[model samples]
Target: MKQNRLIQNIILLIGCLLLNSCYQNEEYMQTVQQNHLLIDIKDSGIYSNEPISRANTVGYTTTFSEGDKIGLYAVKNGEILPDVNNVCLSYTEGKWVANSSISYSEDKVGAIYYAYYPYDQALSTFNKTSTDPFEALVSSWEIGNDLTGDIYTGKDLMTGFANAKLEGRNYTLDLTLGHRMSLAVIKLPTTTYNFTNAGMSSYNVSPQNISFTIGKDSESEAPILPYYDITSDTYRILIHPNTAYTLKGKFTNGANANKSYTINIGTDIDKAQYAQYIVDQPEIINYTLNIGDYYCADGSLVSKDGPAPSNCIGVVYQVGTTDAIKNDYPSCNHGLVYALKRVEGDPIKWSTSKPSSTNWYEKYGMLLYNATGVDIQGYEETKTWMDIETGEVEGVDINSIMKSTLNDYRQNFILPSTTTDWYLPSYKELDALNNNATILNTQFSKVNGEALWTSATKDISYWSTTIRRQDAVVQYHPDNKTKAGYIRDSSGYYRYSFGF
Candidate 1:
């Protein structure tokens, strides 16, 4: 009986071992049938002026550059898996490898994952408990939000993601990595300019190492720093994407070291287009910052409005397009006689508010009205201010009258040339100067002759100029409220003024 029992016990033990072995084999087969994930990461590589192409995929030997950290995450249906382990992939020996706590998988399928270069410290604690992949990313990784921790290094951030879904075979996930930041590339080609030293113009060394900011103001939220790029041979800086920004900078010259410059970026920027889905892609947005052709004295960049004129202050005063002035003039002109600077001393009286007579009003008044009899007003003053017709003056010339009535201090001053002849402006021209007061103030400021004088004297009242009535009208300020409407032709109280 003892021998039979021993034999039966041995058989039972063998049966248990075989059953365990079969169960293990079945579990292994089930694991093999589970779905795998393959993330084919890509970049659009859209650079300025470059043609668009296919998306670039990160290859086996591809990895983030030094100082670049990438953050990634996996998702399935909606929730983030805490047990999935790694959320960050580091660049090591030109290969993107899983973090210390996670194992790299070459298999095509797995759980959802999230990864970013220059990993986000703000979401370091994110794991299985986190739900909603899109919501999590939007909340934690906002473009301008703060990413705290030693891992972030406060550098520009890049991001990518992969969704979690079971696949019987390799499931290809075309993941795109985009920059949450932007860059501005500026190029200052070698240029030769004559510098004026001690009232003389001569060649001088061009300035180098300009400091700049890429926003509306110095306190802007999205500021830019200019750096040099070797490959493209230009200056570059990172900026916020999809936002309007102005390029501003400062360069030093002699005593003008803090001169500032500003230029508009026109539109928001998209991503930089790199080569077609190739390997060894750098994480950056290449934006070619346009510096225009000319740099103004105010430290601003301006486009080349044709060859700059000589013997002028370089301020383009666009005038002459109203009433009797039918001649087509240049869109921009050099400061012919003077700019709106504060000139000191007494105000010179223009003329008396006489009746509609031939001496002054009839001769100059016709110049203020169209040939078909349209009284020029401030309706569209910018379009009409330049309409002074010297050819239409029947009697008293506008330029001669202005010179005779000007204060003795300005009697022998340089007169306006044929191309830039100065003359008393009508109601429309005066209004144009007032409308552009802000721009004028920014460009020029003089203490002595800051006041404006118009050649419009009306017979009855100040409103006469507006109604195109009997000619004698005058205004002390741009508002047209202050006036000496009843002054005499010999009235020294009013001063002579004209537009160039």
Candidate 2:
């Protein structure tokens, strides 16, 4: 009876074990069929010009650059899962792996998820993790708010949401990261000039740096450091998505000056990008003079239209479009005549002496530049200010000969005016003055000034800087507007005109 009892107990125990194993198998099968959550993540956008890594530095990317990270939030049963709140889903190995596991209970209707790139630490403690799909339409982003993180180091804020799609027993949530922010690429116009050659430290005429304001700018301050791409010569600035902004930066001349400008980036910057080419030109032509204005002794123009100032040296009579008067005035487009009033004593001759080394001035009649033809207009007009400045009569420029005491032009320093700044006016420039002689003479009278040409009939003529090699020196007196020149050795008064 004892043996039979032992055998029965062993069989009962074996049956219990077999039953338990069968139950475990049933449980495993049930677990396999249970609904679980899964996600397939991707980025959706165009390729960017500023590449930070595998993804664009400006954050407009359509593919994941390995090692990219994003915050994942899951919602089930109309409530955001506590464990999935701003949970970091880092791209690892070959897949996105979550630090903490999250699964939807079978009782929940469907799983919803919101994911965004460039996870921020501040978002973890935020209490409001609402499950609304439109939660993105309005932002509570202070600097890098919500789970959006507003901006990455040099990237746009990418956010996207999707409803879970069911695949048999698994709920797969697909999140495609996208963003709406202005990607500003500021570039200065390519200039051929080397600014450093002209005493400048750094001559790239570009904005120092760019900063942006979200909303009204009065609401909050969000300044971003721009990424400069030297290869492309571009500066990239990322603005907060969907917010009104004003991008600001001071345009500068190397390290010299600051030029301020305000550009409104209202809703227009939504998901768009632009390349602003700053129109900057280094100064080579400075225009400050106009006809009928007081030309200062120092070659500066008086602001007003009429009357001469106490420092007046000459009156402006002509402007550009005339090469006859063009000279070494590096900062001006116009020039002034020297000593508005002529000779301290009385009118003098063109010269009392000539160079002793040679009688070339006597034989050529002092007009060496127009040696070949004096009758033909083009041939006779071959002379320019450069010829007199460069041509030397016995190793002496014509200007030095004129500045000599033997000539009528004074060498003494005229108060408020430097006689050195003066140059004898050419025939074309003298003609230009002749055209406006009446007005100039009128101004001279008003300023207690004396002018060379008082009128057309004033037999009182002034010496000119022009000379024909075959003829005598030219005179300021003109017989007609069309004549090439008039050469007369008759003693004449003298005045000098200066190029600004």
lDDT winner among the candidates? 2
Evaluated at residue 201, the lDDT of candidate 2 is 21
lDDT against the true structure, per candidate, is: 0.39, 0.51
Worst ten-residue run, lDDT, model 1?
Answer: 274-283
Q: Under the 3 Å rule for N, CA and C atoms, how many clashes does model 2 have?
A: 6
**lDDT (10s digit) by residue, model 1, range 1-500:** 99999999999999999999999987786555443333445543335423332333211112346444455665554555453434555556555544543322443145556655556556645444554333344334433322223322344445556654445543445566655554455544323232222321222222344566555334464444444434553555544554456766665432222345555654346433222111112222121111112223322223233243122232323322332232332311211122333223344433322344434444333333323543333322222222433333334322222234333324444432212233333354345445654544333332222323334422211111322323334443554433434323422232222222
Instruction: Name the lDDT value of residue 349 in candidate 1.
Output: 34
Model 2 off-target regions past 4 Å? 1-38, 46-59, 62-68, 120-138, 143-155, 166-171, 193-216, 219-224, 229-233, 241-244, 251-261, 271-500
* Alpha carbon RMSD to native, model 2: 22.5
* Cα lDDT for residue 300, candidate 2: 34
lDDT of 1: 0.39
> Which tens-of-lDDT digit does each residue in 256-344 have in candidate 2?
23455555655444453432434355422222445666655433345335445665667766543233323332333333443476555
lDDT of 1 at 161: 64
- Clashes (backbone N, CA, C under 3 Å), per candidate, total 67, 6
